[model samples]
Structures are given as C-alpha cells and as structure tokens.
Target: MSSDPGEPARRALERARQSIQKIHQAAIRHRDPSLHEIADEMSEVALILGHDAGPVQDWRPCPVCGAEPGSHCIQRPGHEMVNGMHPERSRL
Candidate 1:
C-alpha cells in the first residue's frame, strides 16, 4: 500500500534517462546513501531510454547477404526482401 518516498523519483528517472540526465546527475550527486542503487537503476534506465532501435537505420546488415547502406536486406538467389529486418548503423 505504501511505497518508498524515493520510489517515484527512481521510477521517473528510470524512464527519463535520455531527457533528464542532468537532473538525474544532480539528484544522484546529492544522495550518497543509495549511490549504488541509483547507479544500477540508471544503467537499466539508459538502456530502456536509449536509442530508437525501431528505425531502419538502427538495424544491422543481413548475415545471409551483404547489403549496401540504406538498402533492403536481400535473401538472395530468389532475392527476397526481409522487410522484418532493418539495417544497423550505416557502414560509414
């Protein structure tokens, strides 16, 4: 029924990693007792709030066939497009 007073802030920071780093840093710097816990929480938070992997540019090249940047992954021979898969960072 009752949650830790810091729970709300922690939860918020967990979801607010990308946009609120400075705020999280300031808060974390001031709080020493739970420094480890905060560090751990922020690690997970960064992953959760990090890059937008859903975009095509975020995908990796197809292991089945080497493709060019901004190009569709072709499962060659028949040359089928793997629409489900996008490329990772561009080669450049």
Candidate 2:
C-alpha cells in the first residue's frame, strides 16, 4: 500500500517532540546545587524553540542586587536545590 503524504510529516513532528521532551528530562536530571548548569541547558532548548536566545549578554541584571545570568545569588533560591534540599543539601 502506498503511504499517505501526511504520515511522514506527522512522524517527523512526533519525533521532534519526543527529542525535546528527552532533552528537558535530561536537563532535569542534571540539576545541581546552584542549578546554573541546568538553567543554561534549558536556555539552549528555549533558543531552539525560537524563544529568547538568552540569557542575552545585554539582558538586564537582577535590579534588586545586580545579579547576572548564571550567578548563584543567595537571594535567588534554585528550584532544583530547593526540591532536593532535605537530604541532599549536606552532600552538595
């Protein structure tokens, strides 16, 4: 039987979605004490999605304290660390 024209496009889209999902999962798995690394990875993914190609060089720093991208400002508690804190904080 001949294949439908739409089938290839649908399959490609599905594969792309799965690939993005896997990347997001890996980024989650690589969470760290400061989460700077994970944030960078997520930023790269966002760039792939046509979102802001950031955190841009000219992006405004955190106005309250001038914190820059990748800076682990004490005021900005990392989501990954917060989730893993209870038992892992000591190990980190």
Candidate 3:
C-alpha cells in the first residue's frame, strides 16, 4: 500500500480526467447543448481537484461579466473593479 497521503487524490484526479474526456466525446457525438455544458462543468471541477490547479487563466474573456482577458471584471453600470473574479470566469 502506498503511504503517500496524496496518492488517493492523484488517482481520483486521473479518473476524473478520464471521465471528462468521455463526457466531452459524448457531447460532441450528440450535439447536445446540455451535454456540452455538463462536460464543461465537469472539466472545471476536475481542474479544481487536480494538483496543477492555479489562479484563473486570463487569456479568455469572461461570459458573465464580459471581462476581457488580462482585464478586471467591472461591476455593472459602473467602472469599479470587482473584488474577485466571477465564478464563471474562475472555472475552466
């Protein structure tokens, strides 16, 4: 038995990656918007669990706040910057 405490989490992370790949494939095959969304959510969750998880990538624009990559998310009707990144933007 592995004495490393992180081993279980590592294994789980690998399994999650495999599951995400399967979900992505099914989403592509069915052309279902809901499936695609689910797959995306699963991928985000997996990334959160993975060891490489880090601060949000700033290369893509946010869908909710319309915050462009490398820019802060501004509150609606105002130019003030939000304290933190939008939840949608934080996801993978």
Candidate 2 weakest lDDT stretch, 10 residues: 83-92
User: C-alpha displacement of 11 in model 1, angstroms?
Assistant: 20
Query: Pick by TM-score: which candidate is best?
Result: 3
Task: TM-score winner between 1 and 2, please give it.
Answer: 2
Cand. 2 Cα-lDDT: 0.41
Clashes in model 2: which pairs?
none
| CA-only RMSD, every prediction | 13.0, 12.0, 7.2
- The order by descending lDDT is 3, 1, 2
For each candidate, what is the lDDT? 0.42, 0.41, 0.58
Ranked by TM-score from best down, the candidates are 3, 2, 1
Which prediction has more favorable TM-score, 2 or 3? Answer: 3
Q: TM per model?
A: 0.26, 0.34, 0.47
**Which residue ranges in model 2 land beyond 4 Å of their true spot?**
32-92
Model 3 spans > 4 angstroms off = 46-91
Off by over 4 Å in 1: 1-46, 50-53, 57-59, 77-92
Tens-digit per-residue lDDT, 1-92, candidate 3 = 99999999888767766665565456556655465467566656756665542344243357777865556665664433345655566556
Best candidate, lDDT: 3
Query: Cα deviation in Å at residue 77, candidate 1?
Result: 6.2
Model 1 superposed RMSD (Cα)? 13.0
